[model samples]
Target: MNIWEYIYSPIIIFIASYILLRFAGKKAVSEMNSFDLLFIVVLGTIVSEPLVDKGIPSALSYGLVFTLVYILFSILTLNNKLRWLLITTPTVLVRNGDIDEKGLRKARITTDELLGTLREKGYATVKDIEMATMENMGKVSVIPKSYARPVQPSDLNLFPGAAFIPIPLVMNGQILMHNMKYLKLDEEWLKRELTRQNIAFDKLDDITLASYNAKGQLDIDTDNDEGHNHNPYMYKPGNTN
Candidate 1:
C-alpha cells in the first residue's frame, strides 16, 4: 500500500516468479508443446495478480505456490519425455541438399525464413547446403556441402604443403631486439629490410603486423591494408605458375 511496500512486494514477487520460471525447465519458446504453452499462460496470469490487486491474499499466494509446484513437476516430466518427443528436438530443415518438407511444417517455419537464414550465411542456393538445422534457440545452422565450401590454396593447386609457421620479427617501430638476438641477426639486417621496403626504421610504427620467413626476410604489413602481407617478394618474380 505504501511506496516501500509497493517496491518490496514487486521485488519479492519477481524473485519468487524467477525461481518458479527457472524450475519450469529450459523449454524454448519454439520448443514449447501445447501443455507447456498453457502452463506459461497460467503462470503469467497468476504472477500478474499481485500487480493488479491492491492487496495480496494468503489464499492467492498459496494457490500460486501450488501452481508453481505443479508446473515444476510437469516440466520435469516433459524434460524426461524429451528423448521420445522428436518434434521438440531441433528438426533438420535440410539434409543432403534437399528440404525436409515434413520437418518444415512441423517446425512451423516458412520457406522465406529458411531462405533468409541461408542468405545470412552467404548461401545463394539450397544446393550449396549439405545440412541445415533449426536449433532450439531458434537459430538456423547450415553446413555447406564440401563442393560448395570455399576452395583453399591447396585445392587451387597452389599449395606446396610445407609445414611453416611465421614468427613476429618486428612490431610498431620497436625492433624485437631480442628476436634479432635469437635468430643471430643484428639490427643492421632488420634496417636493410626496412630499406628494401623503402620505409624508414622510425616509420615502422605504421606497421600493424610483421613477421620473418625461414629465409630470414623481414615481412612488413601496414594498418592501411588490414595487416595483409604487403611484402613484394612473398612470391618471387615470374613464378605465377
Candidate 2:
C-alpha cells in the first residue's frame, strides 16, 4: 500500500520472473519444444506468489532476482564455452541432395514439416534441394539443386569482376595513409586533384564518401559544413564541386 512498496513491487516481480525464465533455459522460449513450454508456464505461476500475497513483497523480490539472473546468464553464454550450453548446434536434415532420416527424427521434425518448409522456400519437391538444414532456431533452410537454381549474372555470361572500380580517398577527418599507399597516391596529388575540382581542403571533412571508378574518374561526395540542408546520403563520392 505504501509508495515504496508500490515502486519496488514491480521491480521485484520483473527480477524474479527473469531469473526463473533463465533457470528454465534458453531453449525455454526459442526452441518452442513442448517440455520447455511447460517449464515456463509452471515457473511463471510459481513466481507470481508475492503478487497475490499482499502482505509479503515476495513476488517483486523474486521477479527482480529472476531478471538479474537471466541477464547475467545471457552475458555468460555470449562468452566462449558457456554459449553451447544455452543453444543447440544446427542439425543437418539433408546433405548432398539426400534426406538425413536419422537427423530429421532426432530434430523431431516430421516429413510433412520438412516438405512444407521446402515448399515455403520455393522447393515443391525434395529433389529440388541440394541441401536442407534445420538450424538451431528451428527454421528449415533449403539450398536449391544446381539445375533448379536461378541463373546468376555469371551464368548469363557476365564477367565476374567488380561492377565498378572503387576509387579510395581519405574523408573521415583523417588522411588514410594505407589507402594512399595502396593506390600509390600522395597528399600533394590529393590536394592538386581537389584544387583542380575547385574544392577546399578544410571542407573535405564535409565529404562522407569519395571514390574513383575504373576509368580513374574521381567521385567526391560532400555536404554543406555550413549547416545548410542537403541530401547527404544521395551524394556520391566523386560528384562534388
* Best by the TM-score measure: 2
Q: Which stretches of candidate 1 lie over 4 Å from their true place?
A: 2-4, 19-42, 54-82, 150-241
Error of 2 at 121 (Å): 1.5
Q: What is the lDDT, from 0 to 100, of the residue 134 in candidate 2?
A: 78
Clashing residue pairs for model 1: none
Each candidate's TM vs. the true structure? Answer: 0.46, 0.47
lDDT of 1 by residue, 1-241 (tens): 6789778877767776676667655662335655566667777777767777744564247546766665655556556566345234678999999999987997899988899989999999998899999865467889999999888787977967576677787776567777778888787887788899887777878887678886668678876653335566454456552
- For candidate 1, give the lDDT of residue 66: 60
Residue-level lDDT for 119 in candidate 2: 80
TM-score of 2: 0.47
Alpha carbon lDDT at 8, candidate 2: 79
